[model samples]
Target: MAILIGTRDGVYRTATVPVEDAEQVLDSGDVPRVQTFPELDGVFAATKTGLYRSTDEGQTWKNLNVPQEEVYSVVASPDSERLYAGTHPAHLYVSIDDGDTWAELEGFQELPSRDEWHTPRHRNEAHVRSLGVHPEMSDRVIAGVEVGGVHVSDDQGETWTERRDGVHDDVHHVLVLGADEYVASCGDGLYRTRDAGQSWTSLDTDLDHRYFREAFELDGRLYAAAARSSPGTWSGEGGADAILVESTDSGETIETVSYPGGPAEVILAWTAVEGDVLAGTNDGRLISRDEDGTWVDAGMIPAGIRSLEVC
Candidate 1:
């Protein structure tokens, strides 16, 4: 299959399409900040209103209804039949039939709160930032709230348990590196929980900055992106200069993948292409790392990207 690349500055920019004009879409009125799915055959993009699907390797896109809610993230269960999406107003949207239709997961409206629920710094916004769905157990899903710590749903979102024990409550992202083992990007930095969400032990001590953008594993190693925002570097340019940290044993130990460039750009929204393990930088660049943890520039992508994932 020949890959054809296109360019878009903000919206649907590039397409490595085939001549057949299969399913290729990236257009206006569509805010696809992030895309990922359990079914690697299709890339599910998280848009402002709903999710989009592309079966033909992003050659084209089709919208799925999920109006009025901002889709922060989406994940396909390892079980295949179940799909999960986290959206604003703190709702865990679920779909049982591929990417057809979605329903609000039961009891999603019942997450515990301090009566006045809001994000730590940005009190106006309250949303689930990340989701850690256990690969072996579909019923057990962990959700990271803006500043409300982590919430666990044992019955597939039917009922929830706030498992912030031994872990930071201001959780941004939760990644299950293995069965019953987890890691969270939280207020106190990187923390790991061995027995599901029951308890945790902090990793990478005193790495200040509560903002942990995303987490994923490559070649059996766990990786996460962090940024230190400032005027010229952070917020967008220099402010976002952060260290890309990795762990060999489910976050037991830490190391830096920091090379020449910094990760101020939203790293998670970019697609982590399986072959090159490409990571999209917020500064409009595509970088890839091999199994040996070496970094090299691959290309450039759209600006204002959210994160990267494989289909």
Candidate 2:
């Protein structure tokens, strides 16, 4: 097995943890996500430059040439008939020919809330930070925008409905749990919607850490990490002052867990390998849970890891 670490610099592939002999597979800048679809041939990397795919594991890559330069997220349709690419400036594109060509999903720009999606921190522009689809809902598409909000498409990106009314607008990622359920990690708070975004429940209402980047689930348990504030306050003496929380009964209740880099390095990405949870930190640390349910340091990469994929 190979672990593909998507870092701020590029994507690195290593066969073993502790990452002693990691290789830079793709030089694309600032990979925000690395994903794989069962219908697709290989791994896909969403980078600052473009969307790329690697057929032979992570050794070499070919740019998919998404129309937008800064591809933030990529996912294949449930039937593998269409490929979606979300990019900076908060635009959506689709490819019907297995990424050979692309076309902008213009309906996304028609959203009434599009004008208010900009954030000054991100150069007054937002990016589609996350895209999700469940196999059961083949025609549904869920998009989480960094400075915008969560939006839903019922006809596979042909039209969109604004589902950001109750949820925080600064969504970092959205984990699609089921056809009608999702957990959104946002800058203000973490939210859960059971009715396909008709309404939302704040999962972090009672927590001190409001800023969340992502959430993961393994063995019927949900794991999430958050910082006291945003990234700007992470460089303080206490670092990010982050905390890792686990919820066995979904997000109704959570308990704090101590890890190798507590209150300093926040876990930003997660992926499962051999039934064990592997997490990547904002400080470039890789930790994994052992049989004893303890997280141990696996190793570190050159740059902070934004995402991870196992192949």
Candidate 3:
């Protein structure tokens, strides 16, 4: 199996799974995320430059002709033709034609707290950092904006309901665990809700490290990647004090997984393929844990990886 890697510089593909070396497949500037849509025979790349799509399994790409700014996240509904894209400067758009065209979900910008959705760094502009969709509910869509808040739309992207009742506003990623259960990773800590987004409870309040980048589930365990502080404080000397945590009780209690000795760095992205959980670190290290519970270096990329997906 081959895995697609979206990095700070470009997009690449490993020679093979349990990869040893990778080759740059697309030279798109700063690919933050890459996803595959089998329904449209498409491989989509969301980059700092713009959104691009390839129907030929990433051999070549064509601009979808939408979103001139950085597309932070992109997702497609399981049971509908609706496709969503979240961009920097905090905007949301929906595509019904497999990304051929899109319509801005204007209602998202009219939220009551929209004026307060601003980042603390880099021009004080927030971005839609992540998105989540439930396969069981076609109309249910969730968006996570960096330094903003998490919002959900039950009627597709037509309208949204924003809430910061429990979770912090500096959201990075959100995942629908099951049904109404949702988990959010934020700059403050990790939070989860058993009753959908109505209410949430902090799961990582006891952990000193607050910054989290990504979370995913593999087999029957929930895995999260965390850092000691924000990326701005991370340096090359020691990298970030990054670690991986596992929760067996669905984010209720977590235990730190052992790591190989090295200067700590944040694991910004994770993915599971063929029952193997893989992580990409801020120092461009592709690490994996074996059945024996040992962390081993799988491979490395030229630049820090932002996202990983099987294709």
Worst 10 residues of 2 by lDDT: 16-25
Model 3 is weakest, by summed lDDT over 10 consecutive residues, at 257-266
Q: Report model 3's TM-score to 2 decimal places.
A: 0.95
User: Candidate 3: RMSD over Cα atoms?
Assistant: 1.6
Pairs in steric clash, model 3? none
Query: Which of 1 and 2 is the better model by lDDT?
Result: 2
Q: How would you encode candidate 2's per-residue C-alpha lDDT over 57-173 as one tens digit per residue?
A: 999999999988899999899899999999998999999999999999999999998999898898999999999999999999999998999999999999999999899999999
Q: What digit string (tens of lDDT, one per residue) describes model 3 on residues 38-109?
A: 555667899988888876656678877666478888888885488888998899988888777889999899
Per TM-score, the best of the predicted structures is: 2
Which parts of model 2 are misplaced by more than 4 Å? none
**If both were scored by TM-score, which would come out higher, candidate 1 or candidate 2?**
2
All candidates in order of TM-score, best leading: 2, 3, 1
Q: Tens digit of lDDT per residue, candidate 1, span 197-301? A: 788787867564445655777667777777653223465334466777777777767787664356445354323453545565555555667667787666554
Q: Number of the top candidate by lDDT?
A: 2
Clashing pairs in 2: none
